[model samples]
Target: MKFKLIATFLLFATCVTAFSQEKQAQKSEKGLIKISIMYPFAEGKTFNMEYYETKHMPMVAGYLGSNLVKYTIEKGLAAGMPNQALPYMAIGTFYVKSLSDYQSAIAPNRDAIRADFANYTNVSPVILVSEVVK
Candidate 1:
C-alpha cells in the first residue's frame, strides 16, 4: 500500500511538471497580431455560419498556427450596441516570434483570403488589424 502511494504521487508530480513547462513556453512567445472581422447580413439572407466554421476558420487557423485564439459574436446578441451595424464578428489572435515573422507569414496568402470571400453571398466582411498591447 505504501509503495502504491509513492508511485501515485510520483505520477502526479510528473504530470504537474509537464503542464507547468507547457504554460511557460506559451508565455515566452512574442509579437501577437490580432485580426478582427466584422460582417452584416442583408435582409432575407442568412449567414452561412457552417461554411465559416468548417472552411474559412480552418484555413485561418492553419495559416495562424496552433496558438491562434478566436472570438465571435452573433446578430441578436450584438443588436442595439454602439457598433450594432455589424451583426457578426470574429476576432483572431496570432502569436509569433517577431513582427517580421507575422508579416512574412501573412503576405502571400492575403490576396487568397480576400478572393475567397466572393464564394459567400449576403455577408459583407470587414477585417481590421491590431497588435497586442499587453
Candidate 2:
C-alpha cells in the first residue's frame, strides 16, 4: 500500500511538471501582438509624462492583468532632422499573446482607461496593432 501511494504521488508530480513545461513552451513558440499608442507632437500641446508613466500606465496594466506580457513607454527626444520638432511627444506600447486576448481585456476596461487620459496628455492617441516578427 505504501509503495502504491508513493508511485501515485510520483506520477502526479511528473504530470504537473510536464504540463507546466508544455505551457511554457507553447507561450514561447507563439508570436506576440504589439499594440502601440502614439501621441503626436504639436505646438503648445501639453503632456504630463510623469503622470502617464507613474499613474495612468500602471492603472491600465492592472486592467490588462495576466493577459499582458509586458508594456513600455517612450518619450520623444528629437526628430531625425537636426533642430527640427519631434513627430510624436510620446509612445506607449504593450505586448500580448494574441489580439483576442488584448481585445477581451481592453473591452471591459475601455471606459476607465479612456477617462484617465485627461490626467496625462491632451493630444489624441493613434493606435497601431501588429504581430511581432523576428
Strongest candidate by lDDT = 2
Tens digits of per-residue lDDT, candidate 2, 16-100, equal: 9999999886666468888999999999888999999999988888878788888999999999999888999999999887788
Where is model 1 more than 4 Å wrong at Cα? Answer: 1-31, 44-46, 66-76, 81-86, 89-99
Residue by residue across 41-110, what tens digits does model 1's lDDT show? 4466555566766676577567755445443434334555686554554333344445465566668888
| Candidate 1, pairs of clashing residues | none
Clashing pairs in 2: none
Each prediction's TM-score against the native?
0.52, 0.75
lDDT of 1 at 107: 83
